[model samples]
Target: MKKTVLVFGLLILALLLMFQFSKYAVISGDLKVELIVASIAIVFFFIGVYINKKTLQKPNTPIEEISHKRIKELDISNREYEVLQKIAEGLSNKEIAQSLFLSESTIKTHVSNLLVKLDAKRRTQAVKKAKSFQIL
Candidate 1:
């Protein structure tokens, strides 16, 4: 979604530049005025982007807060943390079982246990929460 927006934004900017600069070659009049205006506008645009980045640079740790909250919220087991590590590495239950030498049914049980203990509706949510709590 962001890529589409970025591509469209660049297209609009290119079109606008063509309209402004192309006027000079055909108009047969003083192009100095147009050049000056465009140059100043571009400089101001860059400066505004610089200032905006600086304004958004405050540092904080949301992960630590989530760890505290999750310790109270989650009821994880030893196997659940193992399941989370596998999920974080983008493993399916069968693949995790293959690595752990467990049966597919056992892996499914551990996954279900992880989901309930972490108060997650799904495996993806459980993995995300585990990362948030630094448990995986």
Candidate 2:
């Protein structure tokens, strides 16, 4: 955070200096108004490009492969796995039922089974265990 603040502070200071220099040049008639404006615009364009490059950079992370063998070993059925994925997405039982076109009670049963298979006490813990097992 401190490093970001410092970098931004320096950029602002440089921009202020450039503006002051342009103002002085205009007042003294040492530079043409059009030339000054063009130079400032060019500087601003480069600054925008720099900021975009810095802020829009995505981290390179390896994609994790789901373990089908682990899922089979855990005895989680396809429908139960689907319900588990929905639960991992933070969906409610009613929402999961609606999305899957199943009854809410059925969704609840799948969740219960997932909890037992994952040996988890809660939905979040079940999801965490599933990820740790590479089944999610």
Candidate 3:
């Protein structure tokens, strides 16, 4: 925070000095008005470019690979995994059933089986465990 304040303070001071120099040059007829305006515009353009490069660049994070072996070890079926993914997306059992074209009872059964297989007491816990195992 202190560094940011110091940098901004320096920038403001530099801009003030430039403006004062431009004013003196204009009064003394040493520099053209168009030249002073162009110089200020160029400085602002560089400042904008620097800010964009610093704040808008994306971080280079590698994607995590899913653990198919862990899924197999947990004996989670494809359909159950689909249901688990839907649950992780904050979907309710009815919504999962609708999306998967399965009955609500079937969805409930899959959820219960997932709870037992993942040794989780709740849906959130199951999702958390699945993420920890890198199987989701």
TM-score of each: 0.46, 0.87, 0.72
Q: What is the C-alpha lDDT of each candidate?
A: 0.74, 0.94, 0.94
lDDT of 2 at 98: 100
Worst 10 residues of 2 by lDDT: 35-44
* Candidate 3 per-residue lDDT over residues 47-103, each given as its tens digit: 879877977999999878999999999999999999999999999999999999999
Sorted on TM-score, best first, the list reads 2, 3, 1
Backbone clash pairs for candidate 1 read: none
Compute the lDDT for candidate 3. 0.94
Model 1, CA-based lDDT: 0.74
> Of models 1 and 3, which has the larger lDDT?
3
The worst-scoring run of ten residues by lDDT in candidate 3 lies at 3-12
Model 2 ranges with Cα > 4 A deviation: none
**Candidate 1 lDDT by residue in tens digits, 1-136:** 7965875587578667766775764476656566756865786587568657866998885544335445446766666667777888999988999998888899898888888887799888987877767665
Cα lDDT for residue 3, candidate 3: 73
For each of the candidates, the C-alpha root-mean-square deviation to the true structure, in angstroms, is 6.9, 1.7, 3.0
